[model samples]
Target: MVGQPSAYIIKKLIHDVETVVGKVLEDRSTEAAFWHPDRRARR
Candidate 1:
C-alpha cells in the first residue's frame, strides 16, 4: 500500500484473482446448465 507494486507482483495478483473468479463463474455456469429447464424437458 505504501510503495509501488512491481510488474511481476501486479501480474501475479491479477492472475490469482482471475483464476478464482474464473473458477466461481465456471461453477455457476455448470450448475445452471445442470438445472436448465430445457435439459429436464428433454428427458
Candidate 2:
C-alpha cells in the first residue's frame, strides 16, 4: 500500500519535469527561429 503511493508520486514528478523541459525546448526553438542570422537579415 505504501509503495503504491510512492510510485504514484514518482510518476507525477517525472511527468512535471518532462513538461517543464518540453516547454523550455519549445521556447528556445521559437527564439532561435526568429533570431537566426538569415531571418534577421530580411528585416
Q: Which candidate ranks first by TM-score, i.e. highest?
A: 2
Question: What are the runs in model 2 whose C-alpha is more than 4 Å off?
Answer: 1-3, 30-43
Clashes of each: 0, 0
lDDT tens readout by residue for model 2, 1-43: 5759988899899999989876776679766555565764676
Which tens-of-lDDT digit does each residue in 1-43 have in candidate 1?
3375687799889999989876776678766456575764666
Cα lDDT of model 2 overall? 0.75
Point out the worst 10-residue segment of candidate 2 by lDDT: 32-41
Return the TM-score for each candidate structure.
Answer: 0.53, 0.60
Clashing residue pairs for model 2: none
Q: Give the Cα-based TM-score of candidate 2 against the true structure.
A: 0.60
Q: What's the lDDT for residue 39 in model 1? A: 61
> Which candidate has the highest lDDT of all?
2
